[model samples]
Structures are given as structure tokens and as C-alpha cells.
Target: MRGRKTDGDDERLPVISIVGLGPMGVRIGHALQAVKTRYTLLGHDVDAARVRAALGAGAVDRGTWSLAEAAAEADLLFLCEPVDAVCATLAQVAPHVRPGTLITDTAPLKAPVLAAAAQWVSEGVAFIGGHPIVRWPTDGDARPDADARTPAVGDGGGSVAAPPAPDAGSAAAVARSPA
Candidate 1:
């Protein structure tokens, strides 16, 4: 794995690549930025604007379009796209990942991801299926159907926003400022 030095700390920063810079991707990026992990975040997406938005929002350290370029030497990789896209992306990314590279995805279903991952696990690329597992409660659940607002899907492991004071059309804003 490649690493970059941080000022005052001799240890090298691990590289974390985030593929698919959509809402989930940006949310992942936002949540990552909220923490103080000493790792470089590299983001990529088929949509250039989303990548640009992630970069501009301080969610990622850098952005790229090439799957191989983004996967090379990455210590950790997060596939934050839809299920089908995640499967397709895994194939393209698996080849470039070095042994010991930990790869995971935000797909709702584990079967597909695990099935797709089977091809590369033997090669030392570890794949884990990521999911929320539990949802405590949402704005919709708390109130009557007439008043409830549907819960917005998030990056799997995080608190969901409550009712009222919603961010217009962007869930990314909600991600930037977590509950």
C-alpha cells in the first residue's frame, strides 16, 4: 500500500479510495471527513460533476476517473454505488488492488456483492458486504402516515435526520452536517 507523510507524524497516511461519488459516496466522504483519520481519500465517479462536488465540498483529497488509477495501491476501497453498479465496479477494480487490500461495498444485498467478490478473495483481496443492519427509527415511523416524511437512505451506518428542517433537494447537505 502507498502512503503519504503527515506533518509531525512519521507514520504514512493510508490511501482510501471511494468509488461512486453520488449521494452515498458524498455522504461517505462527508462522514469520513468528520473523523480525524490520517488517510488520504481519493474519489472517483462516472459522473464528473459529482466527483467535482465531492472534491469541492472537502469530502475527498483528490478525484480521478480511471478505475485502475483509483484502485492502485489503495489500502481500503469503498464502493458506494447501486447494487448492479457495485458488482460491475468490483470486477473492474479487483484486478488493480494489491493483495491485503480491503474492499467493501454499500450495496443493500449481500448475495450479489459476495458472489461477485468470490472471484477475487482467493487472490488476497478481502471483500465484505456492508449494510445498515438496523434502523432505529425515522421521521416517518415516529408520526402518523399523514404527517410522516419518508426516511432518506444514507451511507448504511449513521444516524438519519429527523422530521422538519429538511435540506431542500440535497441529501449531501444532510451528510455534511450529521446528527
Candidate 2:
């Protein structure tokens, strides 16, 4: 009798790319990798060394120089860039984002970010503002549990989900600063 083949044998995982290889960015990439095996965490930065470091550390699977390249393949794009960098990044990558893509950011502040997101909305991209209630030290070697408890999403009469959990060893336990 001939051997039977199964569809599972050739299945491939969807690639999820993360732009910006900063501290938080690396952590976001790793966090997703921790949960799913099919993830392709694409890391990028101005500095080639940072991209190398993230890949070497297993935080990201590979590196891409262009934001548009990564955005095209990402099912969900997580932006871990600084507050000031996000606006320009979005403008540059807006044309490449496919329709119905879910984009999120972890900027420190809220007001300015919300304004920036409005522009993307005009361009047909959905942006959600999330401030991970945590921050890691300059030198920490741990990651948060993939299933750690995170904040609930509130419908701001808008389309963005709540922020995700912070890095494992983040110094500021939550993304919010101590009062």
C-alpha cells in the first residue's frame, strides 16, 4: 500500500515581524517567539550591531533593513521605538502596510501618540496606543512569562487593543512611572 501524506507535514507558521530592535523591541519579538513556533521576529535598527546582537541573543530570528519589507510580512507589527521616532517611521512605512493590518506602539506618553496615530488612520492603517506598564533596567537578562497578566482593553470608541506586558526584568515593574 502507498504511504499516506498529511497536510500538517508541510504547514508553515505565519511570520510576525517586529520593527526597531531597541530594548523593548527585542523583548516584544522574543515574547511572541516564546508563544508560537512559526514566528519570524524581524528586527531592525539604525545600527547594524544592534540587529546582530538581537539575532545572536535569539530574540529575533532574522534582520531586515527596510521597515516596509518587514511590514509586508508581519501579521501584527509592534513598534517599540521612542516617542519621537514613531511619527517619522509611520510616515515612511504607511505606503507598505497592507489593508486590515493591526499596528501597535509602546510609546511612553499617550496624547502625542494618539495624534500621530490619527494620521495613519487617514492612510487606512489602524494604530493602537499601548504603554507597557513596565520597564527593564539597562542590563537585565530575563523575559516576562508569555501568559503574564496584562491590562484589559477599553473601547475608546476606537479600534486599539490594550497594551501588552513589559519585559521580564523590567526595572519599573509596570510601564507607568512611580508617582
In angstroms, give how far residue 134 of model 2 lies from its true place.
1.9
State the weakest 10-residue window (summed lDDT) of model 2: 149-158
List the candidate 1 regions with Cα displacement exceeding 4 Å. Answer: 5-11, 133-179
| Candidate 1 residue-wise lDDT, 74-139, digit = tens | 788888889899888888886688887877777777677777776544456666666533232454
The local distance difference test score of each candidate is 0.67, 0.60
Q: Would you estimate the TM-scores of all the predictions?
A: 0.71, 0.68
Q: Number of backbone collisions per candidate, in order? A: 0, 9
Colliding pairs, model 1: none
lDDT score, residue 17, model 1? 91
